[model samples]
Structure formats: structure tokens, C-alpha cells
Target: MAAGTLYTYPENWRAFKAQIAAQYSGAALKVASTTPAFTFGQTNRTPAFLQNFPLGKVPAYQGDDGFCLFESNAIAHYLSNEALRGATPQAAAQVLQWVSFADSEIIPPASTWVFPTLGIMQFNKQATEQAKEDVKRALTVLNQHLNTRTFLVGERISLADITVVCSMLWLYKQVLEPSFRQPYNNVNRWFITCINQPQFKVVLGEVKLCEKMAQFDAKKFAEMQPKKEAAPKKEKAPKEAAKPQEKKEKKKEEKKEEKKPAPEEDMDDCDAALAAEPKSKDPFAHLPKSTFVMIEFKRKYSNEDTLAVAIPHFWDNFDKEGYSIWYSQYKYSDELTLTFKSCNLITGMFQRLDKLRKNAFASVILFGTDNNSSISGIWVFRGQELAFPVTDWQIDYESYDWRKLDSDSEECKTMVKEYFAWEGDFKHVGKAFNQGKIFK
Candidate 1:
């Protein structure tokens, strides 16, 4: 069995391939991603790390016996057992073919389609549309191939499945909503099957499929730009002193060249930019400090009974003067198809509004069955103003119609009780409660 340490950043899908392979093969693989072991830019750029992995890109690997490898495919291949590599020469060749396909075919379009949504790349409408078509084409090919097969290569899971799944992970999670993925049923089934396996699950925890397709957020994109450093003041030396200084600098440069290290290579421009980016100012910093604690309510809602305990706590502690209640309903309910997809819309919205959770609490629910449903939710915000209009939480808010509710009104109380409890008759929605997701 191969025993080694893998160096990479956390949640890096590329590193997942080798980790999953190691799990299946029972290889003793140690990950060095966190502090003290490895830190992305600092650790990877170190002289010791660059000596082993010259390019400094990851997921790089170094074995106990001194064998070292870079490039995700190479590392995964090295870590795989014969069963994962292939059972025969032809099987191994086929595995290589699929791995190459994942790199050449899936990655480009996947990165282009998914990066902008991640706020790592600038959005270009024309380029994004093309990437969508390209992704569809790739999925169509996989769908056809997987129509009669459970796995990609043989009767069992192999490196081929791992590579392709990792390559498509971001795509499935960010853009491949149910409607867009409906045509590629076989691909969807195979992808789901692969991810659910013990090996894949060990590497990738619960993989939530995209409910609503993500869009490039101009606010998030702008926030990712590196903070500009102030330019240093320039000082000029005397005309005669300049020549002696230049010769001294040339001598210093020549001596330094003798011990020069490997050139630092840029890998994943977005990752580098994100590391250098500054923390954003809190959007709700100007709001008055409310006595209501959003986290405490969320904790009770999660752990305690909703109707008997959590609901009462919400009503008792809700600061009417400091906080405001609002009702939001999806404007395009007619376009919502699958129930799961509708739920995904709620999930996606909650994810985008993560920053708002400190000052907000919401019960966004999906109503009715597949092909016939409505989405409506009760939102509690720290201030009277519409939070989304004034904050960066505007990504999905425009998709829903918002109305400020009178906190003292009986109608508002009923809506809050039902939404928070997730069981009351939603007469306003006119549909049965299918599922609910909370944002706090």
C-alpha cells in the first residue's frame, strides 16, 4: 500500500480524487491542508515544498520512500490499486482514456461555467451561454455512455469515475439544476451513484445538488479584488553616487543568483486573489443593536420542538421595535418544476444570504408537489428597511416579491407561527407545506 502525505487546500476537488482513491485502496494517506501542516500560499511557496513539487500547484504527493508526484491525475493514479487502476491492460488503457476526457473535455467548460458563479471570474454573458451549451454537450455524451452501465469502466468503480466526478463536482453543485439536467438522466444517475459510494462520501461529504442555477454576483466579484497597497515614495540618489550604487546592486544580484530558488508559479489565479482579498465591512454595522439574538433562536429551532418551545421563544423575545417581519413569495412560481428543485432554490438563497444570518432569521418554505408548487417565507430582519435592497443579499431577492408585515397584526402572527413551525395551514400559499429551510 502506498503511504504518503498529500498537500492541497481544503475543499479542493482536485485533491478529492487522490483522497478517494486512497480510501478505496486502503492506502495510508495523510492530508496536510490546515495550519501547522500546510497553508496554501505560504506553505506551498516554501523552499522545501517547491523542491518536491517544483510547480507548487497541488494536490502534490510525497511518499515515505521519497517518490514524489504532482498533477492530480498522476497522484491519483499512483495511489490507486490494481482494481481502481484497471483489471487488465485494456481496462487500464480505457481508464486513462476517460481520465484524459475528464481533463480535456469537462474541466474547461466546467471552470468557465462555474467560476463566474463562484465570483472568481468576471461574468461575460456570451461566454457563459457558450459554456452552458458545452456542458450540455459533454453531459449528453456521458448520458449515452452510462445508459447501460452502472460504472464508467468495468463492473466496479475505478479512477475513471473518480476523475470525471471530481471534474464535474462544481458543475453539478453550482449550475446543473434539475431542469437543465433532466435530459441527461443516465449521467445524473451515474454521478449520484458514484458520489454516494463509501469512498467518494469519505472525501466529499453530503453533496447538495444545485437547486437554482447560480449567477455571477457583481457585488461578490468586486469584493474579491485585492486591496491596493500604497506605492512607496521614490527617492533619487546623487548623479555620481548612482553609478557606484548600480555596480554594488549588480554585485549583490550576481551573488544572490548562486542561491536562487525555483521560480514561483501562479496556480489558480482566483485562489491566489481570494487569499489576498481583504475582509468586507459588515453591511448591517449601522443598524441599532437589537436585544433579539438570531443564533439563540436558530439553536432552539434546531434542537427544541418548533411549536411548543421554539415558536414561543421567538414570540416572547422578538424585539418588535428593533426588528421587522416581512413576507416574501417567489414571483416565478409558474416556472418552478420539480419539488426538489424548488427546495434547491430555497437552499441556494439561504447560502447566498449567509452573511445576512447574523442580523436576520427566516423560514423559507416550498409548498405543493413536483410541477405544482409555490415558495413563500417569513423573514425577520434587524431593521425596518428591506435588507436585500440595502445589502449584498440582492442575488435572489429580486426573484421574490417582498412585503413588510406589521409585526403586531394577527395575520402576521399567524404567518410567523405557521412558517416557523413548518406545519400550520398556509392558507395564503394555497398549497401544502412540502419542505422548509431556515436561514439564521
Candidate 2:
């Protein structure tokens, strides 16, 4: 067994540590705090530390193989090899894509938006604004893609969601104001789902949505500025003539203290004050209860069969009125086009499905071009019977297995049916899936 020590802050650094601990239960994972006070006499910065990690960064891992690794993402990748990596080559590739996307796209903007305000890094107004803009832009890209799919790469939880999520944990905790995240609803929903997972909870603890900080107001800020002292009054001359008292008018006045309000009146005032205070709404108020049917569509079609036979059949026979079509693609397809245009194609399908009142969600993916050459995924319809036509692909449907879940019992056939009817509590299950493509 190898001993791995992570030198980092508990809050921001715990996600990575938790992932490793949860996945590789056999390995010993220790926390070595680097907050100057904690690290003063720590072994992390000693000569032995330099031998392992020259940079002396927190989260450097020394494997049982005597191989040492640094960089949180890389270390997480190394740690999650068997536990988080997909069983197939394609699954592994999707994981890599998501991890890379998290590192390259998510971390930069998050660091830019959060670090300065926390006083952890130098503040640059222009850079912060630019970073926010970039963050929104990147979120838009993710939202557009995630609007249809549950997870990032594969059919199950993968390293991609884990790593990128870890990177953004800081921003979600500190920087993302409600006003900022609300517009990115899909992103928010996805993030909430990820953090709420049991494994994540163990590592990251319960992630609460931080209250949005008050915006800077110029007038209020000015009011808060310390007032300057007025120049000392000019000293009076030493010699002063005595003044005679003037003749006076006669009037006697009595001063009296006003009585306070009665206890009943005070109670009413307190009640009024309580009533006047604004209450915050639960962001998940609209989220449906977790009840759904998982429909698995397995098809083996040649390139020509997918385009010439399968796709048209799907559009024509798909239960447009009863079921929603989620356009799914393999996480590993090289021929797949990567552009905003392809994203729009999927978005358009979702829009059309919205008209049907079937409450269908769709996601498209291109996986495995890297780790494995194969790609696959499924379009999940949450209703009763799929109203659409089944083309050539073999199809199977099963309600969410209640036996596996610890939450609700009472077999939820009605709940599943209601999900299809767009009735009852409807929650988003953003599990990653392995989906194959259907060409039209």
C-alpha cells in the first residue's frame, strides 16, 4: 500500500482527497495543511520533499511504485485509474476529455473570478471582469451541451465530472453569486447534482450555496469612507472683557420624558418587523422529485444503416406526443463535428420536443476517439410507455430500481408515469451514459 499526502486547505482541497479516498479505499490518504502556520515545520518543504516534488506544491502524490506525481488534476487522474475510469477504452477517453475541459476551460476563469476577491491573489479589476465574462461564456457552452445530457462523458460517474467539479468547487463556494449562476440554470442544476452525490459528500462535505455578497454601491461606499477632521478652531485671544447679563423674559418650562409603547404595541411592532423581512426561496423548489424510467436503446448499425435507415425511422416513429427524444452520440466519435453548429442541431431538437409537452431531454456526445475507438450513449425518456416508434435498435425500459435506492420505497409506477406526463415531482438525473450515435 502507498501513502499519499495532500498538502492543501481543507475546504478547497478536500474534493480531490475525498475522490482518492473514496475510490482507492486501500491507499492511505493524509492531509498535510499548507496554510503557512500549519506548514512551518512540515516535512512537505524539506529536502526530502524536493526529491519527490521539485515545485513543492500541495497535493503531490507519491505512489506505491516509487513514482511521484504533482498537479491536482494529474494526481486525481492517477488515483482514479481503476475506481473512476471506465471499463472500456471509450469510457476512459471521455473521462480524459472532461478532465481536460475542466482544467483548461473551468479552472482559469474560476481562478480569475475568485482568487483576487479572496485576497489570495493580486486583484485586477479588468482581469476579474474579463474572467467573469469568460466564465459565463464557458458556462454557456456547458449549459448548451448539458441541457440535453445528464453527465459529461459516459453513462456513469466519470473522472471528467469529478475533476472539473473539484476545480470549480472554489468558485461555487465563494464567487458564484446567485445572480451570476441563476441564468446558467442547467450548469447550476448539474453542479448541484454532482456535489450532492454520496461519494462527493464524503470528500467535500455538504456544499451549501453561499449567500450572494452585496454588490458594491458607489454612494454607499462613499458614505462609509472615514470623514476628515476639521481644522482646530482658532485659539481665542488671552484677554477677554467681561460681559454684563441682559434683562430677561419670564417663562417656566418643564421637561418630561416620553412614555414608551405598551408591551402589546411592542409585540405588534416586532411582528411587523418580522413580516417585513424578505425570505429567500429554495433554488431547488422547482426540481422534480427523483422518479424516472431508464430506457436503454441498444443498436448495432453500420454507417450507412444509421444514416439511411435508423435516423429517419427514429424521427418518424419516435413517440413525439408521448416521449421526448434526447439526441445522443458516443463519447468517442472522430467523424463527429465539434462546433456551435452541431450544438444548435441538438438544441433545435430539444426545442421541437418542448412543443410536444412530453418533457423530453436530449444529449449528444463524441467519446473514445482518444482512449478507445468506440463511442455510445442513450436517449432517456422518463414517461410510461415510449409513444414513439422503435426503429431497428433493440430497446428496453426499466423504471428506476427502487431496490437500489435508499430514499423512497412504495413502488413508484405512478411516479414514473407522471414523469412522462410531465406531472409529479420532476428532478434531473445527470448520470453519465455511454451512447451510440444515430445519423440522419
- Candidate with top lDDT is 1
For model 1, the run of ten residues with the poorest summed lDDT = 431-440
For residue 226, give model 2's deviation from the true position in Å: 25
Steric overlap count per candidate? 0, 30
Q: Rate the local accuracy (lDDT) of all candidates.
A: 0.81, 0.49
TM-score of each: 0.55, 0.45
Q: Which candidate comes out best when scored by TM-score?
A: 1
Model 2: ten consecutive residues of lowest lDDT:
247-256
- Give me the runs in candidate 1 sitting further than 4 Å from their true place: 230-440
Q: Per-residue error at 26 for model 1, in Å?
A: 0.6
Candidate 2 matches the true fold with a TM-score of 0.45
Off by over 4 Å in 2: 1-3, 12-21, 24-26, 34-42, 214-440
> For candidate 1, lDDT tens digit of each residue in 1-440?
89989998888899999999999999999999878898777887789999998877888999999999999999999999999999999999999999988876688768877887887665644346757887888898899999899999999999999999999999999999999999999999999999999889989999999999998887886666444444444456556645667887986687667545342233353357344434567777887788888878876775567788888999899998788999999999789887646765785677556557668888877777667778889999888888888876587888989999998899999999988876666778763434432211
